[model samples]
Each structure stands twice: as C-alpha cells, then as structure tokens.
Target chain A: MAETVKLLFSATRETVYMVAVSVLIASIFGIPLGVLLYSTDRGRILENSPLNKALGTIVNIFRSIPFVILLIMLIPFTRWLVGKSIGTTAAIVPLSVAAIPFMGRLTETALREVDRGVIEAAQAMGASPFQVITKVLIPEALPSIAAGITITAINLVGYSAMAGVIGGGGLGDLAVRYGYQRFMLDIMLYTVAILVVMVQLIQVLGDLVVKYLSKHR
Target chain B: MIRIRNLTKVYTSASGTVKALDGINLDIEKGDIFGIIGLSGAGKSTLLRCINLLEKPTSGSIEIDGVEMTGLSPKELKEMRKKIGMIFQHFNLLSSRTVWGNVAFPLEIAGFDRKTINEKVENLLNLVGLSDKARSFPSQLSGGQKQRVGIARALACDPKVLLCDEATSALDPETTLSILKLLKDINEKLGITMVVVTHEMNVIKQICNKVAVIEKSRVVEQGTTFEIFSRPKTQTARNFLKSMFICEIPEELKAKIKALNGNLAEGRVVKIGFFGEITAKPILSEVVKKFGVNANILYGNIDNIQGTPFGTLVVQFEGKNGTADRALSYLQDIGLDVEVVEIG
Candidate 1:
C-alpha cells in the first residue's frame, strides 16, 4: 500500500509536469498562429484567403491525427527534439505538437466570436491592425479564449495520460503496469479516481474564470 | 472644411459592378451640420464613409482642411483620421471595456499618456452626461447611454469633424430627440463640423442646416434644409418631402371627393402647401372673405422646419360663380403652392 502511494504520487507529478509544460508551450505558439489564421480569413483585417486556407489545412491535418498514433508517429521527431524516444520529458514533444493545433483552432474560434463592429470601431479610432488585435480583438475575446485554454489544458491532461503508454511515466503507465498487468484492481481504481478529480478541478476552475470574466454576469 | 468632388464608389462582386455612389460632389463648410438624406439603398452611407475614406472611392477627390484625402499613405491616413471622428448606428462601444475604458480607447490609440487619457475621458464622460456611469459596462446602459459613450469616444481625440451615420436611428423617439439635442449641443459648443447621414426626414428636420438628397446612388438635390423643405426642386425631392406630411386623402375625405366628383360645378378640392411667412398669413381667411367662398378644410398638417412653419392643407372650396376657382388662383398668386385635386 505504501509503495502504491509512492508510485501514485510520482505518476501524478509526471502527468502534471507534462500537461503544464505542453500547455504553456502550446499557448506561446498557438496564440500567434490563431491570430494569423483569423486575420488572414476572408474579409478579415489582413484578408488573405489563400494564406488562411493553407494555415487552416495544416492545423486540421495535425488536429485530425489520433493522439495515440500521433505519439508513435512523432517518435523520431521527439527523439531528435529532446534526445530521447520514451520518457516524461520526451513525451512533451508529441503532446505539444498535437496540442498546438488544437489550441490554435480553439483560439481562432474564440477570436471569430468577437463582434466585427467592435473591430471597425477600433479601426475608425485610428487603431492600427496590431492595435485592433491586441486592444480590441484579444481583450474582447479574452473570456472565450480563457475558456478555450482551460479546455485545451484539460485535453492535454488526457493526452498526457496516453503519453504514458511506451515508458512515458504517468498515471496511465501505473494503471497499465500495476492494474492491468498485475491485476491490482485497487491501484487502478485509485488512479482512475485521481484522474476524475483532476478533470473536475480543471472544469470547475475554468467555469469560475469564465463567469468572472463575462461582463453579462 | 471638407470638399468632395465627383466622389464615386463602385463595388464589384461575383454578380457584377454596383455603383454605390456616382459623381457625388459636396462642400461642407466648417461648423455646418450637413445632412445627407436618402431612402434605404440610396448611397447616403457610402457618401458618409467616403468622407473618412473608410470606403475607398472609385474616382474622386476629397479635401478636408485643404489636404487631399485620397492621396495620403496608410500611415498618413491614420494620422489624418485622428482629426475625423465617427459614431455608428449600432453605438459600437467595446463590450469588454467600461464606459471610461471605451472612451479612453481612442486616446490610448492616439498614444496619449495615462494621465492625459484619464483627464480626457473624464471631460468626455462629463460632456456626454455619462460621468456617473464611467465604471459601468456598455451592456448595463440603455441605447441612449450607449450612444453617449460612442459620442464621448469619438470626441476623445478632439476631432475637427464628426460624422454621424444614422446615429439616432436605433433609439426611441424621445431618446432620439435627446441624442439629437446632445449632438447639436456638441456642434455649437465645440464648433466641430458634422456630417449626418440618415433616411428619416425627421432626423434631417431636427438638426441639419444643409441637406443633400441622394436617390439611386446620385445626389438628386442638395441645398439648405429650409430650401429642401419649403421648395423641393427635383421630383425625387418632392416625393421624399411628400412623405413628411399626412397628405394622403383620409378615408372620410376620399368618400367626400368621390361623392362630389362629376357633380362638382362650382366646388373643387385644392391641396395647398405653404411655408415661411406664408404659413403665418391667414391666406385661407383672405380667400374666403375676398372670393366669397366657403373653404372647408378636410385634412391639414402644419410642421415647423428650422423655425419656419411649413404646412399642407387640403380644403374643399364651395360656392357658385367660379369664386372657388378664383380662391385657388388667389392662393397661388399669394405664393402658396395650390394644386387642384381631381375629385376622381
């Protein structure tokens, strides 16, 4: 029982580390990508349809790939990136790669929800395109974007569990090794309970932030 | 302080080219509350947008304060736009910002320091009577208050010209009046030139000193509000002005006209339109006493246009021996527009 507790603790730490680092990295790249995607859309501020389509296709291709296959498929790239093919640190490469497009698409949708009239009002006030994005579009879309980030982070939690399949240590690795392989039902149940708690915490925290940011409240 | 010469905007889409504005020329002197009035799809909005170069013209020249607008670079245009403020019909206040933040948005874009932004926003909120609502979000305000925020934001840069694109079209009648009053007050207080675009004649009647009537993408007529109201020159202008009065033959009057159709020997119905000092004169009484005719007023509407009384009256003149005809002729001779209404 004591050994199981220790394993669960380490597994949770690994999972948290993977999800947090990947979400941060994903956001850094994903936000600008999302803005570019929205700006290049038809009739938008930048308005380059071809560029929008190209970027959309790339994001779609990455998003459509199953996370399981994406993890295995990115093994070589992951090996090259973090100098290892299987570990908690190396799993971040595949997790972040898969999550970047997910975050980008979500961010783009959040941006699209911003009122065009508000954007025009900004432009009429002599706001440059950058100002329109930073001042008007981003701030107006903040609540929605924050909600999207929460969703992406929660999704990363799930993806990080899957990353534990091939020696990428996390709760999923412990559940597979101790519960499925060794048939320790108690160990599996405890890990499953912890995962559920993590998900619920993320959702509750996200809802709180969204409620606070929403002005209609 | 704005001159638009042959300003045309052509929009080409999948279908074909649409001439939103064609050969539009306008001269708005400084401090003038110029109105561009037209029906829906008449290109009044396109003309207003052209002033700020929001809608690029197909072929034309716009000069504001003697600087050619169409020739400016993007950076220069941005700088020039600082002097021109615009308020939209929807009261496009940023939903994410408080009233103070929304008003400060323009100042921030103009790169004012934090202290200056705060002071300007304070003065602007006071100017628009929204100082108490500074911390409130736009969603918390009524339509009039939202527009007041829009007005304050537009004035934050101390713009030389203010463009109103149906600024009050979204408000209730009482609210519209208050917004118009505020706009007029701003105009007088700041001496800022204003260009107002709207389809509602009442909007033009209430505030516009000069008006340009656009029809089918062309400037059908342009003149002082008094001129357009008192003496509409074009057929389009006449038709547009006709909508202002309740001149349609009422149901009861229609029955009376039908009854007295062919049997009208020494009686006739005449629709008389008079304006300015003419409305002050009791011309109908003069005609009654002079021509010995009994003038029965069936329908009438007297309106005040820019301190001038403009009225339309439909009267049935009845008498024997052509006195009724002489009465109408006399009303015409006295500078009243008298049109003989056919009883059919």
Candidate 2:
C-alpha cells in the first residue's frame, strides 16, 4: 500500500510538469498564430485570402489527427530533438505539438467573438490596423482568451496522462506497470483517486480564473 | 462646404441587385444643419455613409473644402477620413474601453502625446457631461449617455464635418430630443457642417435648416425645411406630410363626412396648408369675412419646423354657390395651398 502511494505521488508530479511545460510552449506559439488566422481573412484588416486559407488548413489538419496517434508519430522527432523519448521531459514535444493546434482554435474562437463594430469604431478613429489588433482586439478579447487558455491547459493535462502509454513516467504509466500488469489493485485505486483529484483541482482553478477575468459578470 | 456629385451606389445581394443610391447630387453649405430623411430601405443611410466613404459609392466625387476624396491614395484617404467624424444609431463605443479611453482613441491614433490626449479626453468628457463617467465602460451607461460618449469620441479629432447616421433612433423620445439639442448646440458652437440621416420628420423639423427627402434611392424633394413642409411636391412628400400634419382627411374620414353631413356639396371641401407667419394671423377668419364663406374646421394641425410654425387645415365651406371658388382663390392668393376635395 505504501509503495502504491509513493508511485502515485511521483506520477502526479511528473504529469504536472508535463502539463505545465507543454501549456506554456503552446501559448507562446499558438496565440500569435491564432491572431494571424483571425486578422488575415476576407474583409478583415489583413485580408490576404490565400495566406489565411493556407495557415488555417494546416492548423485544421494538425488538430484533426488524434492525440494518441500524434504522440506515437512524434516519438522519433521527439527523440531527435530532445536526446531521449522515455521520460516526462521527452513527452513534452508531442504534448506541445498537440496543444498548439488546440489552443490556436480556442484563441480564434475567442477573438471572433469581439464585436466587429468595435473594430470599425477603432478604424473610424484613424487607428492603423496594427494598433486596432494590439489595442482594441486583444484587450476586448482578453477574458475569453484567458478562459480559452484555461480550457487548453485542462486538455493538455488529460493528454499528458495519455503520454504514459508510451513509457512516459506519469500516473497512467504507473497504473499500467504496477496496477494492471502486476494486478496490484491497491496501486490502481490510489492512482485513480489521485487522477480524479488532479482533474477536479484543475477544473476548480480554471473556473476561478475564468470568473476573475470575466468583465461581463 | 461639402459637395457630392453624381453619387451612385449599387449593392448586389444573393437574390438580386439593389440600387441603394442612384445618381445623387447635393451641395451642403458650411455650418448648415442638413437632414436627410426617408423610410427604412430608402437609401438615406447609404447616402450618409458615402460622405465618409464608409460605404464607397460606385461612381461619384465627394469634395470637402474642395479636396476630392474619391480617388485619393490609401494613406491620403486615411487622413481625409480623420477630417470627417461620424456617430451611429447603436452608439458603437468599445465595450472594453472607459469613456475617457473611447474619447481619446482618435487622438491616440493621431499619435498625440499622452499628456495632450489626457487633457483632450478630459475636456471632451466634460463637454458631454460625463466627466464622472470617464472610467466607466459603455455597458454601465444608459443609451443616451452611451451616445454622448460616441459623439465625444467622434469629435476628438475636431473634424470639420459630423455625419450622424440615425444617431437618436434607439433612444426614447425625450432622450432623442436631448441628443438632437446637443447636436444643434455642437453645430452652433463649433460652426461645423452637420449631416443627419433619420426617418423621423420631427428630427428634421427640430434641427435641420435644409432637408432632402429620399425615396426609392432618389431624392424626391430637396429644399429648405419651410419649402419642403409647406409645398411638398411629390406624392411621397404629400404622404409624408399627411402623417406629420395628421390633419389630411383620410378616405375613411371623407366617406364618413359625406354620410354624416347631408348639406355638403361636391366642391365645398378643401385642404389648406399654411406656413410660417401666415399661420398666426387668423387667415381663416380673413377668408370667411372677405368671401362671406362659412368655415367649418374638420381637422387642424400646427407644428414648429426649425422654430418656424407650419400648419395644415382641412375644412368645409358653405355659402353662396360662387363664394367657395372665391374663397379658394383668396387663400391661394395669400400663399396658401388650397386643394379641392370631392364631397357628397
């Protein structure tokens, strides 16, 4: 029973590390790409149809691939990039790759909700397109975008657990090695409880953050 | 002054084509409060948008202070737009911005320094009687207050002309009047040319010195408010005036009168339109005394148009057979419009 608790704690820590690192990397890249995707469309400020369509299609294709398949497919690239593919650190490459497309879509949805009339008001004030994006669009969409980020982080947490299937040292890997294969019911029960607690914590944190950020409420 | 020549705008929809503005030509003098009035889908909005190039005309030339706007380069067009301010029906202030920030937006776009922007925004907020609301977002303000913010923001750049597109339609009548008064005050204080588009004749009557009535994408009547209301030329104008005056005997009323008044003759009914000073001098009494015609007022409406009184009266005349014709001629000679109506 003690052994099961120790393994569950270690798996929980590793899962947290993977989710944090991947979500950070995803946000770094995804937000700008999402803004580009939103602004560079027909009738928008940038209005480059071909560029917008090409980038949008690429993001959609990446998102359409199931995360499990994506993790396996990214193993060789992960190893080549990170010098190993067996630890939680190595799993971050696939996790961030999956998270970027997810976050990008969320960000696009957030930005799309900003009133077009607000954009026109900015333009009527003689604001350049760049100023409109930086000053008006981003500020207006901040709350929704923050909520979107929270949703992305929660999704990354779930994906990080799936990473344990490929020998990434997280809760899922511990459950498989000791609980499933060795038939240790005590380990399985402990890991499942910890996983539920972690998901609950994340959901509560996300709800608080969203509530704090929302201006409408 | 602003001049729009040969202005045309065509919108293509999935179903068919709509000519929103067709060959519109207009000249608005500087410092004039001009009103463009029409029903919904009457192209009044389309015409107003063309002034600021918000809705680009298919083919036309717009000249503000003798500078052509139609063919300017993109950079120049941006600069040109800064000289023409506009307010909308929805008070399209940014929900995310405070009143101060909204008012300062144009100055910021103009790249004014922070100190100058702050001072200008403060002044504008005070000008709109919203200094206390400088930090409040638009959602916290009432409709009239939101529109005041919109007006202040549009004025931030100190544009030479202000285009108002149904700016008061969303407000309650009392609020609408206050906003219209504010617009009039702005015009008087700044000496800025103002063009307002509205469907309400009362709006035009309140502030507009000159008005153009648009119908089916054409200007059916364009004149001073006095001329348009007093001598409406087109059938559409007459119909619009009927509603405004509310004294034009309807077909139902005429039928009822024929059935109710058995003594009424075929040519005894007439409608009279009186304008300005003529409405004050007991013109009906003058006609009655001079022609020995007995006047029975069936309907009457008197309204003020831009501080000038205009009136309409529908009456039945009974007298010696020839007296009715003499009374009609006498009214006409005194500058009243006398339209004879059939009676039983």
DockQ of each: 0.68, 0.58
Show pairs that collide, candidate 1.
none
Model 2 over residues B290-332: C-alpha lDDT tens digits?
A: 8888898987788888778887788888778788888888888
lDDT per prediction? 0.89, 0.85
Q: Please provide, for model 1 over B83-122, each residue's C-alpha lDDT reduced to its tens digit, 9 standing for 90 to 100.
A: 8999999988888889999999999999999999989899
- Model 1 stretches with alpha carbons more than 4 Å out: B261-264
Question: CA lDDT of B286 in candidate 1?
Answer: 84
Question: Clashes in each model (backbone N, CA, C under 3 Å)?
Answer: 0, 0
Instruction: Judging by TM-score against the true structure, name the best candidate.
Output: 1
The Cα error of candidate 1 at residue A93, in Å, is 2.0
Q: In model 2 chain B, where is the ten-residue run with the lowest total lDDT?
A: B259-268
